[model samples]
Target: MEMSNMPLGGHWVLVIIMIILATWVIYRYLAPQNAKEWRNAGLIQGFIIALYAEMYGFPLTIYLLTGFFGLEIPWLHMRGHLWSTLLGLGDVGAMIEMIIGLGLVILGLLLLARGWSQVYKAQKENRLVTDGLYTYVRHPQYTGIFLILFGQLVHWPTILTLLLFPVIVVAYIYLARQEESAMRKAFGQKYVEYMKRTRMFFPEIKNWKLLFKKG
Candidate 1:
């Protein structure tokens, strides 16, 4: 593949814009309330920056693959869709992956937003939030984060992001456990009952329809 005609780098502006936009949406919807939440948020911030930095600002993964592994990937921006490229699916596969990835991102954002709204209102009333998304998952906002990050992974896979993904998941899982401990203290047996009924992250199959319905 000829590399001279297809440029691969110098897209820092797009990189900056994407990072800022993604971080803003994340902070806005899933606003961190304390030190722990903020720490987890920082991990996500780093993930976004590293993901976009490689995606637009540089093609480190492509370079590493071509130079170190001796692969012959073209240096086109579209070639950044590594999964499709590796799978030999070409442009059409990239488009399909992008559409699916974007769909997951949108769904994650909706879940984050709705979860935030409900939790905020419940906090004001000093009540437990076990309705709406909370009816399904004990930690819907975290699930949203999972979805968004997974979506980004599908859209554009990078070494750094791949490494950070599981770390972020583990961090959120720990955070969720800490949160549950507090909720258990605050709500006593009521929260215990809720926990018994609702799964921590994944929703039950029978209650799937309730996810689409308004709370």
Candidate 2:
């Protein structure tokens, strides 16, 4: 079948499934508790919708690239892997990028799960969580979110998603700061000291091994 004539869109079922799965994972693990967290989660929800809509429901990005920009690209679903297509990597290259993206998504999920586990335990004890993923970054959940979003971008670079990526990043950073402010009020000097010792998002290079360490 010709790439242009191949079934390129109307996969609403797949899109809905992806959105539901992504949103479920986000809410289940992150468990946004406040308005700020909810707002950030909304942004992620928008991102997920835009991503899958383009990935399955409609190839708007592909359409624009080939139609508006006059790029000589095919309209096949596989050809929608723009990064691999643009990089001239072909099918093998697309597979490689997909693998890398999947790896990142898995890592991000692990971080979210581990961070939630530690935080849930600490909350039960009414103490600050400063072990496991928390020992590395002050906001491992946010870090995981970034990783997941970036992984999706790497896997499929759609126009809408590419634009939304940085906006989501900024929103999460703001939300993280707001959460930290509340943490300071709740934990006082202890949180202040933790902030001093730990980075907000990224972990220190030397402490990278702790991410693999089992608690």
Candidate 3:
């Protein structure tokens, strides 16, 4: 996977545009309520900037690692996909990255779409969203976003983004708490009952049979 002499790939404009478009989509079709919730979007955009900037504009992590650690880590390798080069899997690494990234991304977007759709319908009818994807997890939208951020890290693990990942997780966790507090006020005992039954972020594996039976 050593391609020290190779020129950098993954153009900056395309990556920037992709991030902008992603931000737009997140705001439009899959937005969370309140200004506090919007902070997640801002953090996500920061991650994207750090991610693609290194991904295309510069190999900051690679350079830093090679400079500080004095390890000859195949500079300019794998088009700034450090994870691939570091693993020494070469093409296999690239394929694994693509597969994992794509899988998580598709799953994330699907969850976001379905979760939001359910929420919208519930809101229209003046009911709390307790069915569909919400039956398994209280915050499928946040979970979707979490998956997307992790997926990007898997695709290309830059230093900045790796650091930003946990921050993003904590931000989402806080946001989820805030969201749940609001939901509790709106729905009262019903939401409390739902909370007692369902977990946030992760579904209960113990309820697999019941989940299979869900509509």
Q: Assess each prediction's global lDDT (C-alpha) against the native.
A: 0.88, 0.86, 0.77
User: Please, what are the lDDT tens digits per residue for candidate 2 over residues 23-131?
Assistant: 9998998898888778878888999999999888988998898899998667777666888888898888888999999888888888888888888999899888887
> Per-residue alpha-carbon lDDT of model 1 for 1-215, expressed as tens digits?
56334577778999999999999987998789899999999999999999899888888888898899998777887766888989999888989999989888878888888998998899899888888899889998998899899999999888899999999999999999999999999999999999999999878888766765676
In terms of lDDT, the poorest run of 10 residues in model 3 is 206-215
lDDT of 3 by residue, 1-215 (tens): 45545666457796778778777868865665778767778788888888777777777887888899775666554544666767777767777887898788777777777777888888799888788888888888888888887888888788888998999899888878987898889889989999999999888787534433425
Shift in Å, residue 193, candidate 3? 1.1
On TM-score, who's better, 1 or 3? 1
Regions more than 4 Å wrong, model 2: 1-6
Model 3 Cα displacement at 208 (Å)?
7.7
Deviation in Å, model 1, residue 79 alpha carbon: 2.6
CA lDDT of 200 in candidate 1?
94
After superposition, the stretches of candidate 3 with alpha carbons farther than 4 Å from their true spots are 1-6, 75-79, 206-215
Sort the predicted structures by lDDT, highest score first: 1, 2, 3
Clashing pairs in 3: none
